[model samples]
Target: MKQIGNVYLIAAISIVGGGLFGFDISSMSAIISGDSYLCYFQQGPLNADGSCSGPHADVQGGITASMAGGSWLAALISGLLSDRFGRKKAIMIGSVIWVIGCIIVSASQDIAMLIVGRVINGFCVGICSAQVPVYISEIAPPTKRGRLVGAQQWAITWGILIMFYISYGCSYIKGPAAFRIPWALQMIPAILLFFGMMFLPESPRWLAAHDRWEECERVLILVHGKGDPDSPWVAREFREIKEWCEIERQAKAVTYLSLLSPKMINRTHIGLFTQIWSQLTGMNVMMYYITYVFTMAGLTGNTLLVSSSIQYVINVVMTVPALLYVDRIGRRPTLLVGAALMAIWLFANAGILATYGTNPGPGGVDGIPEASVSVTGAPSKAVIACSYLFVASYAPTWGPVSWIYPPELYPNHVRGKAVALATSGNWAFNFALGYFVPPAFVNIRWETYIIFGVFCVAMFFHVFFIFPETAGKPLEEVMEMFEDPNGIPYLGTPAWKTKNYYSATARMEHGEGLEKKMSMEASPERHEVVGAKEQV
Candidate 1:
């Protein structure tokens, strides 16, 4: 089969796997606000007041969270599948599963059926979400790595925006069609990705690990060297990957537990924290429950939908700058700045809600209110702006960085498992938040923002203190930097003081090979041992 060699095309297509995630996020946001959807899920007659009677708060929260629960489990197991079957194949499998899930969801008749379908789709999200970045990171050159991997975030934003609008438009239709149409529409990207991945090359590093050296070299040549066999870039990268493969071949088997080894644990923490903190930033609340937030802010009907849709546009638009400049700006600064800005927005929004909002029932843990807090006038508008600004702050920073950073943290041997573990942490928190945030709105009201705001502040310090920069560094160099005994510091002259360590080490090893070759020239085994050592 003819393979796509352009990094951009591969990123664009493989990233379609994450599209369902975007769809699920904003689709539910858009669908749940519809009277038809509420009526359908309620499975009963409308209230005598002509209001749609939705499912109970707990049942609704479970329905909303079921997908994340499924995603968490799928992401946990995805690494083994990717390692055994290859990243591209793993993603292809995910695409097919997503299509099935979409079909089931579109036809769901009750809350249980809907939850089952969403959970199935969540499995697809988990598998694809874990591996797409792994695949892209392996194929992309170090300099372009950020842009390509960041494209995952950009694509997700696009999915969210497109699906949200589709659901918004479908909202006008009578009955369950309002929700079913959008669910059915989501299958397109998955089907495209299923067929699209057929034409995309598998990860070169994966090929190298399996000892398919020729295919690996060809991939490196085609993707990075512009088809030039003699290109210095390809020659250098191939050498590094080949060496890593050789090293890994002799290493012990890697498992999830292996990620906690002394050499790997710090990176595990970094990767895990990188993903965890992103969810803790409260971006998903704005995304998954935007309509709820807007509803509480006193906006209704088209005005609420329009207001919600604009944020999706902002999400898509804001991601572009990060997609272009993340490598240039470096990872550490983007994370720190993003966290700080998100903190400001969350804090400001929380304060505004606490001061301007009115609570009628003030529900407790056992007795949750139907509506937590309601605001009207300028304060509600200000609260809405804060939500938009929070998303704007997040889109360029944590949104892209979280997806890219974890895959960059480990060597090929453990990269799949480690990335999966990190992603599992992400989905775990995602599921927890998705499951609880709805009830939280009733129980605590404005305090939710306060928790996330503090998390943003804490994450800022964490990034500054412990998180090392990974942007533009070759995987081997990142590996060595973490393995260094003295350690890279955040406060005291940090993140690998030596530049070009990977290349320099490669040269030193090459020079040693030459000296050994010269010494072997006098030995009887010269013809056998040192004959083709320098060929690559």
Candidate 2:
């Protein structure tokens, strides 16, 4: 019970890193569209009515993309840092960086300063995004892993929802201080995470890998037993971990190049493409630009803010179902169902926008349409409804699933690098979307939804034909799935429907197979020694 408590506490604190990630996603959406922001950034002259006077699409995209760009680089390197210094330390370093970034962003005097601040924050996000899930997966039992790791995504949604409301409340304030207050508020989670992590135990897997067997045993007992290292369940789990660490130590030294081995490549591909497909789903388009989207739907001022807040609320509420059921229902099913639902909503949104939506007039600035002149009734409401449905579908499936899938795919030796590469893919594509969406909306209007709709269809096929089921399987057994040629013979079949899918670890737990294999591999003389003992 205490062990489980520790796991939840660690997860709770660690996911605040995810909250900082979410806070940044929508922070600029509200601030960048404001008149004070425009005037202060010097993008162009302000109107007599106090609106941005001209298009500043480039500036907007640059500011948003800069964070992703920094994250891209940071994610690529964070794996090395985490592997060397440990996941907890990497997260603490990131939290400190996050505080630094929040201070800089809150105090920015110009666009350049703002970009630098956002980049620093993005760098922190990169480190946390890659490390948090790895840390959670290491600590959580397989049965609870999905929900626990899923908490990171929940934190992100909460961060987005909270920041969205904060930005909205501050939208009423009259100066740069409006945006500064929200930017400064980002420091709260970072501070909490940094201080909270100081008391948590380091990953037991990492400890075993470093040959700190005593500490590893203690942590496992604390996490898996009642502070009794000799408890049967704890002994079995620790033995397996130690055995795997020994095997890895004897096989080959783990390095970046080791990921290219045939055994690891498939898992690597799964991790990388999952993140890529997630970005292609177009969730961020709505997440980072809900106010802009609501504006296009003919809402303005406080009305737009309230409507956007509803979208985020729906996101937070729907995510709860996923937390409850992802382990029960499994990862692949949720993803396939989500992709199909998101596709339908995307197409419906596109159809509504194409037929009845309005484009921004030539004089509009920063992608906000000038003076609502388009459909105001049923079509507008339909577009809003479809957008909400899209977010609802995403909240449960891709939103949390993407973060949960990658870290579990690799063995401990290269788990850090695999997650780093996958996270970098997430941010790289995230950067592309962030950089392009404002311009895409301005130039293509409703067609943007069509593009995302196509990506959703593609995602459905990918999940059905490619992703293997990992739920309920132990981490070491999951590695064997990738290595076994017949483990995933029916990729298109739901995991529950597949006959070939079975848990080797569960079979071991039942005393069916592992003892024989361990004896054969770990000690050929075990049988002889047992025979001699029996004869005596």
* Residue 21, model 1: Cα distance from true site in angstroms: 0.6
Each model's C-alpha lDDT? Answer: 0.84, 0.79
Model 1 lDDT per residue over 1-536, tens place:
98889899989999888777998999998888688887777744555566765777677788888998999999989999999999999999999899899999999988889999999999999999999999999999776788899899988899999998898889889988888999999998998888999999889999988888999999988888778887656776787788778888887899998888776788899899998999999898779888778877787789989999999999999999998889877888899899999999999989998999888554421122445788889998899999999999999999999998999989999998899999998899998888888878877888988999999999999988788777767777677556645554312234434232123344344342335324644553343223223321
Per-model TM-score versus the true fold: 0.90, 0.90
> Clashing residue pairs, candidate 2?
none
Candidate 2 per-residue lDDT over residues 1-536, each given as its tens digit: 12343677778988998988889987877676666676667566655466564337766778888899889989988999999999889999999999999999999988889899989998999999999999999878776788889999999999988898798788788888888999999898899888888878889898888888898888877866657655555666677788788778876876767777766777778899899989999998788877667766677767777788788889899999999888777788999999999999999977877787655465443335422224568887887898999999999999999999898888888998889999999999999998898778767777888999999999898878778888765577676555545565422234344221223334334322255445634553344323222321
How does residue 383 of candidate 1 score in lDDT? 92
Worst 10 residues of 1 by lDDT: 527-536
